[model samples]
Target: MGVIPALVILYFTIKGYEDYFKDKKIFLSFVAGLLAGFFSVLFESFVRNAGVVSLIVLIPFFEQIVKTSILNSRLARGTEGAPIYGATLGLGFGSIFIPFSMVIYASRWSGLDIVGLSIVTLGAIGFIFFHGATGIYIGYGVKSDRVW
Candidate 1:
C-alpha cells in the first residue's frame, strides 16, 4: 500500500481509539476484544484446515463480533463513541495486515511498470477503506441499537 492509504487507515484507527476512550471501561473491553480477536486465530488449527474461504470469513467475523459486543455494550450509556471505536479496530487490524501485504506486493511486482504499482496502491487503499467501513458500520449498529 502507498503512504496515503496507510495514513488513511491510521486516521480511522486513531479516531476509533478516541471514541473508546470516552469510556475507559468500554475502551479496556475494546482492547481486550481486539487482542482476543487478533490472537484467537493462532490457537485454531481446525479453522486453518477449513480452507481459505472459511478462514477469510471466520477470522474477521470473530474479531468484529467481539469488538462490536464491547463497543456496543457501552452504547446504552451513549453512542457518541462508536465511530472512534470502530475506526480504531479497523486501523489496528489493517496495520497488522499492511506490512505483510506491502512486502508481498513489492516482491512480486517490484519489476512491474508504474501502472502495476499504481494498481497495487489503489488496491491497498480500497482494502483498508473497506475494512474501516466495516468496522464503522458494525460499531455504529451496535451503538445505535439498530442492529447487533
Candidate 2:
C-alpha cells in the first residue's frame, strides 16, 4: 500500500529533477501540498454533510481548489520552476492523502477479506496516479502562466 505512493512520489520527483535541475524549493512545496491535503480532508467532512448532490459536485471542486491554492499564491509567482514545484507539491499531496484514507478503509476490514482489501488497494494506487498526473498538469499550467 505505502510502496505505491512512495513510487509515485519518486517518479514525479525524479522527472521534475531531470527536467528542471537544482530546484530545492520543490521540497517546501511538497510539504505545503501535504498540509493542503490534510486541510482538504478536514474541509471535505463538512462538505460531505450537505447531501448527495453536493457530495457529487462540491467535494471534487473543493478538493481541487484547496489542493492547488498554495501553488496559486504569490509565493509561486514569477518562479521559473513553478511547474516542477507544482508537480512535487501534487506528488506530496497525493502520497499522503490517498494512502491515509486507504489505511483507514483497510483497518475496518473484518478478518481476511482479500477481495475487499484488494479493491481498496487498487483504488489507492489508481488515486495516487490520478493525483500525480493532475499535479503535473497543474504544475505545467502554472509554469506556462496558463493556470490560476
Candidate 3:
C-alpha cells in the first residue's frame, strides 16, 4: 500500500529536484517546496471537516495563490517564472507531507509493529507526487497570466 506510493513520490520529487537544479534556483526550490507542504497540510486540515468538495475546490486556488506569492518574491520578471515557481511549491508540498505521514503511521502502529510506520513513510512519498503535480499546474497558470 505504501511502498508503491513512496516510489511515485520519489520519482516526481526527484524530477522536481532536477528541475530546481537545472535552473540553479536552490533557494527558491527549497523554500517553495517547504512552503507548499506547510500550507497544503494546514489548509487541508482546516477544511477537512467542512467536506472533501470544499477542500478540493478551495485548496487548489489557495495553492496557486501561495505558489505565485513565492515566485513573485524571489524571481525576476519572466515567462518561465510561473512554471518554475509552481514546480518549487509542488516540491515543498510533497516534501513536508513525508514526515507527517511517518508520524501518522507510527501512531497507527502504536505498540504492535513497525508496519504502520513504514506504511506512513511510503504513503507520504506517494503524496509528494500528487501535490507536486498540483503545484506545477497552479504555478503554470500564475505565470501565464495575472489570474491571481
Candidate 4:
C-alpha cells in the first residue's frame, strides 16, 4: 500500500532527464535521499512533541541539508544537470518518506475508506512534487555557485 505511490511518482519524475546523469550517480543520489528520509523519521520521533515550530523549521532545514548533501561535494558541483539530479534525489526522498508516513499516520483516522485513502494519496502527491521542485531550486544553486 505504501510503496505504490512513491514508485509512480519516481517513474514520472526522472523519465525525462534520467539520461543526462550517470545511472550510478542518479542511483547514489536516490539512495542518499532514502537515507535522509530514514534520518528524518528518526528525528521526527524526538521532535514530534515540539509543536508547529519544529514542523515548520527544523524538519525542513534538515531535509534541505540532506537533499543537497550529495551535490555539495566537489564531485557534483558545476555539473551539467543539477536540476535533474536534484529532482531525482528529491523524488527518491518523497517516494519513501511520504507514503511510509501517511500509512503510519493514517491510523489516526477512525476507519480507513476509499475517500480517506484518496485524500492521503493526494497529500503524498503534493509532497512528492514539493520535494522534487525544491530539489531543483537547491540543485540550481549548487550548480551556479549562488544560493537562492
Best by lDDT: 4
lDDT of each: 0.56, 0.66, 0.60, 0.74
Off by over 4 Å in 3: 1-24, 43-65, 72-77, 109-112, 146-148
Clashes of each: 3, 0, 5, 0
Model 4 has a clash total of 0
Name model 1 segments beyond 4 Å from true: 1-49, 73-77, 104-121, 145-148
Which 10-residue window in model 1 sums to the lowest lDDT? Answer: 25-34
**Which lDDT tens digits does candidate 1 get at residues 1-148?**
3334545555546653554455554445345434643464343345767788767888667766665665566543256566666655554444444444455577866775677666766665665566567767776675666742
Cα deviation of 61, candidate 3, in Å: 5.1
Pick by lDDT: 1 or 2, better one: 2
Q: How accurate is candidate 2 locally (lDDT)?
A: 0.66
Q: What's the distance in Å from true for residue 64, model 4?
A: 1.0
Task: Give lDDT tens digits, candidate 2, residues 1-148.
Answer: 4445645565646673565634466667767777777787778766767899888888777767765677777546456666666666666666665566665676766444777767777676666566666776766666666644
Tens digit of per-residue lDDT, candidate 3, span 1-148: 3334433443555563453334556445656568666767777777867877777778767766666566666452245655544555566656777666665556766652567666666667666667667766765665565645
Ranking by lDDT: 4, 2, 3, 1
Deviation in Å, model 4, residue 94 alpha carbon: 1.0
TM-score of each: 0.54, 0.75, 0.62, 0.82
Worst 10 residues of 3 by lDDT: 1-10
